[model samples]
Target: MALHNKIGVLGEEIAVRYLKKEGYYIVERNYRNKFGEIDIIAAKESYTIFVEVKSRSSENYIELAQSLYHKQLHNIRQAAIFYFSEKNIHLSSIRFDLIALKIDPDAKKIDKLKHFTNIIN
Candidate 1:
């Protein structure tokens, strides 16, 4: 895998662990369709969430990560809509989430992590 892809995979794994620890039950990962790809799909309480994970080696990950997929959020949303239409899921609510991570390239550990909830709106 390329360096950025490796970073993304590692960041996504970390995001999954963080979500589980935060009481979200993982429904799926890497859900892709004609629209786009959603890095993680999870459920918590009454919400089914579509999450996008972004990773960077720099400490300025907040803006960088957020900007990286700002435009692609639409594609993720489209995929989520397609997903809901095809699945039997009946969550009371739906959400779009973002998990941004700054990883230590050498240690492969997170230097910073932020989870933005309901980001589309």
Candidate 2:
């Protein structure tokens, strides 16, 4: 795999761990539809969350969360809609979330992570 892909995989792993720790039940990972991809799908007490994960080795140059562009958000929304419809789920509430992971190469650990909920407008 390419270095970038490896980094991305690491970031996703970190995001999943964080979500599980936060009491979110992971329903899916890399869920895909014709519209686009949702990195993670999780559920809590009253909401189902569609998550987008951005991971980077460092945040000094650019923050990982900043990479979620408008078009990407649109795609994620479309995909989420499709997922719900196909599953025949009438959710009380649905939300979009972004999980940004900052990896520290030297320490071989995640330096930081931020979860932004209700990210879609």
Off by over 4 Å in 1: 68-70
On residues 1-121, what C-alpha lDDT tens digit does candidate 1 reach at each position?
8988899899999999999999999999999889988899999998989998888997575575548555687788789988987785554589998898999878999999988888887
* Clashing pairs in model 1, backbone N/Cα/C closer than 3 A: none
TM-score of each: 0.91, 0.91
| Worst window of 10 by summed lDDT in candidate 1 | 61-70
Residue 70's C-alpha lDDT in candidate 1? Answer: 53
Instruction: Report the lDDT tens digits of candidate 2 across residue range 7-100.
Output: 8888888889999999999999999889998999999999999999887886732455668788998899899999988989885588999887
Q: Global lDDT of each model? A: 0.87, 0.85
